[model samples]
Target: MKARIVAETLVKGITVNAIAARHGLRPTRISDWRRKAREGKLVLPADKNAVFAPVKLAVPAIAAPTPPVPVTTIDLLKGDVTIRLAGDTPAARIAEIVAAL
Candidate 1:
């Protein structure tokens, strides 16, 4: 019962030191009582109509990951030589063609 009173006083915005002083106990004892109440070891009277303000969590919205686009390359255009190729074209073959050109 004493622990409950100290916990209630602490909940009412009173400092733990002040509550302990008022009850002729140490501040550590009041803190222990508060911890017990928080951990469900000590049950306080439920005030059915006690109103609390709404709380909003600042969580960001998750976005979908974008897929990688296909890549195609090679736009070799010279005086009279035109060579268009895909991205996977072999470097040796391209070098050979360019050497021939």
Candidate 2:
């Protein structure tokens, strides 16, 4: 009887709350069956008209490290003025130079 109720509740267009209310059972009981089904403990009867799709899984591959991009220099040009700077120059010094220009 419980399995029949569960099957009816699982049918298309049927809801657990509606089936529970109709059968005077708690919604939690119906939901428990659903949870069990999800965990492979409960198996619902297959419908004759049901269509299933094949699932494919790929084996996880090891990730390779990304090489760092090389930073060599910074060039600031304004009109006939050109400022050549190293990539390792301090940000505050760069800001001061920019502010002075």
| Candidate number of the best lDDT | 2
Root-mean-square deviation per candidate: 11.9, 8.7
Residue-level lDDT of model 1, residues 2-101, one tens digit each, is: 5567545756667888877887889888788878888888887765668999999989888888865755878677788788988777889888878877
Candidate 2 worst ten-residue window by lDDT? 1-10
Candidate lDDT values, in order = 0.76, 0.84
TM per candidate comes to: 0.43, 0.45
Q: In model 1, where is the ten-residue run with the lowest total lDDT?
A: 2-11
Q: Give the alpha carbon lDDT tens digit for every residue of 1-101 in model 2.
A: 55567778767899999999998989999999878877877777766778999999999998998876766888888889999999888899999999899
